[model samples]
Target: MDRVLADDLHALHSLVSGLRRDIHAVTAAFSTSWSSGQVEGHVTRVKLLKRMGFGRANLDLLRRRVLRSP
Candidate 1:
């Protein structure tokens, strides 16, 4: 990181700074097997469904769509 900053590659410098700021998370991501992939997928799916039904979907319809979704 010091070397990167010294090299004055502004783009890489900013990226390294961000990685340094979140060093703990960066290390944990590399070290951990656990993830929120399933939860995130569900959230994304629900958001997509909601968007698809935009102005017309009521609670019941949304519930049914979620329940019926694969």
Candidate 2:
């Protein structure tokens, strides 16, 4: 951060100012490599399948689709 300030204080200040509220969260995310994208995708798939089955398919069919699709 000192090196960054030496090179460009304005940019450093801008970045810090922009991320002040979430500085800890942003730094933690960069330091760690955990994500919920796959879980989110599965949830999205389930939601879409449910919508597609809207009043037409029964629970059995929906269950089968979820199991088979995944």
Candidate 3:
């Protein structure tokens, strides 16, 4: 009974190890440079520019203001 339980545990560990390796390979193949940090920075800059514009600038003007200033 003890030997059977140990064998079952060993098989489960092997399966889990294979799954982890497969997941790592998949992530490595499909990752991108555009990460959460970049997205957060863009969102923060947009909000800052919107507040600075005081709700008067049109979309095109606002976009120009944000992109052209810095």
Candidate 4:
């Protein structure tokens, strides 16, 4: 990381810096088996459906769409 940061010509400098800033979280993610991937996927799916439906979808329609989605 230091080597990459030290090299002015390196394209990875910015990425390395970001990784350094969030090193603890990055390491924890690698070390831990627990994750919110399923919850996040559900949230993303719901948000996409809401966006697609926009002002036309009612609560029941949205509920049905969400329930029916894979």
What is the C-alpha lDDT profile of model 4 across 8-43, one tens digit per residue?
857898899899999999999999999999999999
lDDT of 3 at 29: 58
Q: How do the residues 1-70 of candidate 3 rate in per-residue lDDT, one tens digit apiece?
A: 3454467577677666665669876576569554478779888988888888786877888889778865
Best by lDDT: 1
Please name the candidate that would achieve the greatest TM-score relative to the true structure: 1
Q: Estimate every model's Cα lDDT from 0 to 1.
A: 0.94, 0.85, 0.73, 0.92
Lowest-sum lDDT 10-residue window in model 3: 1-10
lDDT of 2 by residue, 1-70 (tens): 5456567568577676667668898899888889989999999999999999999999999999999995
Query: Model 3: clashing residue pairs?
Result: none
Give the winner by TM-score: 1 or 3.
1
Between prediction 3 and prediction 4, which has the larger lDDT? 4
Q: lDDT: which is higher, 1 or 2?
A: 1
Candidate 3: segments with Cα more than 4 A from true spot: 1-35
Q: Total backbone clashes of model 3?
A: 0
lDDT (C-alpha) at residue 39 in model 2: 96
Q: In candidate 1, which residue pairs get closer than 3 Å at backbone N, Cα or C atoms, i.e. clash? A: none
